[model samples]
Target: MTTGNIKPTKEKKSRKSKPVVNEKSPLLPTKHEEDAAGFDEFNGASFSGAVFNLSTTIVGAGIMALPATMKVLGLIPGIALIIFTAFLTDASIELLLRFSRSSKSVSYGGLMGDTFGKYGRMLLQICVLVNNVGVLIVYMIIIGDVLSGTTSSGIHHPGVLEGWFGVHWWNGRTSILLITTLAVFAPLASLKRIDSLKFTSALSVALAVVFLVITVGITVFKLFSGTVLMPRLFPDVHDLASFFKLFTVVPVLVTAYICHYNVHSIDNELEDNTQIKAVVRTSLTLCSSVYVMTSLFGFLLFGDGTLDDVLSNFDSNLGIPFGSMLNDAVRISYAAHLMLVFPIVFYPLRLNLDGLLFPSARPLTSDNARFALLSTSLIGLIFLGANFIPSIWDAFQFTGATAAVCIGFIFPAAVTLRLVNLISNLICHQLSFCHLKESRFQFSLK
Candidate 1:
């Protein structure tokens, strides 16, 4: 929960990470302290924390557009692509764990710095900053939709500081931003531990699951009831090229899968490294399964048509419920999710910025620091791009190429080589150092 100034080593500029527990610097925590923080209060996170980290990492606004992604890739290839992406991501995660074992550091940014250098750390900072902004834009759009729908439903929009000002004022956009700032960012900023929000994270995952199940049910119902109107649920050879194009869908999904950054915080709370791995594996598997099923069924039912939300995407011919009520439900649920997700992304943005620019500053202790950084970011987003939220898929493509692939693919390979070199030179003492030589071989193949 409390990071406790666990800084990554800065002495190594070579693309080779020095193991953290080497004899030169033997002050590293014992195996128990290395596994987790030794503080009584912040020793380990609950199962709820694991679920929260997993769910928050996995769920993105991308679920809304998965139908479109599937349409682009077609059926069989689309499924294959998703599976392949999952496997690739899993491998990267395992490599990250191996790197953690070698370096004895748990944070993703720290691991990256250990593996690469100052430049790599800066690159990760930029990636997290951009990704966080993208997420903010999404929440803005989602909040706007919710506000619009709520105002239209024979209810007045919530006014800001009405009691303080002794007057009523209503602006949908401003209201949403104010509420988001107060309800989401305020709590997130005050928190010292990322694991504290595990409950909300678990709730979000559950909600996503419910949404998926409802979508699959609707899809199956539509199919069986003979009201299904989409193209046949089958692949077309002509769509093969487009299937590769669908790789654009990987970034945000990868972002949604990014749990490494928070691993340090989680590890501090965990007693057993094996338990942590088990939890991580279970959470990722469950989240991915839900996402894949939801995407597949939504596409099967709706085909290429617009599926802003899975529930509302169904055709008009298949009567299910009151249109207005369902629309409101979908909008409200989405809005709630966006709000819950804001902190998860926002804190990382704050941490990365602080780490890169003002590594010594404590934004947590200073109100001025928090407001200056967060408000400036939010205002810039509102002024620059809140009105036209960029395409999620396009954003994902850019993020995948820059952040996901680099962090997931390149960093892991680098660390593995560094670890092999450390082990071979120190433990085995082989004159030829065949293992060290083979490290580069694996890196090249990767």
Candidate 2:
């Protein structure tokens, strides 16, 4: 070896020692293998889980008030508007997929940041914050109503609250709110993953199915038995202004069907982002079918002039167990559901809040911190809107108009266009680089 090459000398080591990491960082899963698994396992959800998530998020507390929305728009046009909104919603989803791919980041906030920069992110975060807050307020109001024995406004028959068990707490809406808040927030505070809410999500879907069966079955039975006659066939459309007035229903329908935020969660859980397209398409199609069927059955059974929140259409003492049973079932389902759903809404809320005030403490782990934040937010919402329940629906409409339309429709398209643009730029850059190399070679040879 010495004959062929020179030997190397030993090197001296430095006196300094490397510093050791005192606090170990949490372990992150190493492999991407799990993501490639089945759609059912990606989000730690089954097929039923997907269905339940879709149904619960889409239905929410809004369904009870749908009759009032339909009443404003009339039957045919109301149905048409529902269809139109569905189309808008579908288009938005398709667009979001493209944007997600181009952005190369998971979740809606990331995609938004890629497209519109900081302002875009801020705007989207604000919209999400408002929507979540709106929903929380709505939930509180609902719990208050149920606890205080108040019927949905039009469902306000005189003796309806008299027979309810909790009617004794008639003036105790504040105590009711506090109790419900604690119940709803406690589990949410402990939840590690929002997606883990699959159980309650499934329960929500079951409740919807149960309600649907009862509502449709009872309506059909009533129709066949001739106990309840159908209402007017078609309302007279005097002018275009009357037709334009139908736009009033747009807010409620938009709010009811809004599930765009759910898409972000679906993507996060998905093994392959491509599956998101499938899930969203499937979910939207299912939701639209449900809405159309439910709306039609609702209008035909209760007639065109039904009030917002369909519960109002029936007589207070409507000797039907279907109504009462459905009410109790839904109450249970949603009550359980709020336990799960609250975290989904709260995660984004906390994210936004962290970004706004406590920039350094983004990933908050302290349970006390979470509890305090939630309590403050909930209390603030109640204080602002406690006396304004009558106008909550109106607020919902405005929130839906901005958040639902943009998040559901516009953002998706913008995202898709951004992805397509990225792909085109990448291709052009490669082609230009190749052409420049060729031109240089020819010039040198010449």
Query: By TM-score, who's the top model here?
Result: 2
Candidate 1 weakest ten by summed lDDT: 18-27
The local lDDT score (0 to 100) that residue 429 gets in candidate 2 is: 100
Report each candidate's C-alpha RMSD, comma-separated, in the order given. 10.8, 10.1
> lDDT per residue, candidate 1, 1-446, as tens digits?
77888887643222122122111011122233332432323244555576577567657565665666567656666566666766776777787776766676556666666656656667767776776666566556546544532222243332222312433345455565666666666666455456667777777776776666666666677688787676544444356685566565566456555555555445444534455566767766786787678678877766766444343343233355463444345445655776676666565666666556664443333445664665566545643455555344455566555765565566667777777777777766674587878998999999
lDDT of each: 0.57, 0.57
What is the C-alpha lDDT profile of model 2 across 1-446, one tens digit per residue?
25657677545211122111100000110112211221222213344455556555676655655655556655677677777877887777667656555544445665676666657766776776677677666655554544354445444522223335434554366665566566666555455444566676666566656656666877787678776655544444589987776666666777777776666664554334445566766777776776777776776667654545454344343345566655555344444444455555555555555444453332344445754675466446644564467544766777777876676666667767666788899999999999999999999999
Model 2 gets an lDDT of 0.57
- By TM-score, how accurate is candidate 1? 0.73
Flag regions of model 2 displaced more than 4 Å. Answer: 1-51, 146-162, 165-167, 170-172, 231-236, 239-241, 271-274, 313-315, 319-342, 366-371, 378-387, 418-446
* Candidate 1 C-alpha error for residue 303, in Å: 1.4
Candidate 2: C-alpha RMSD to true structure equals: 10.1
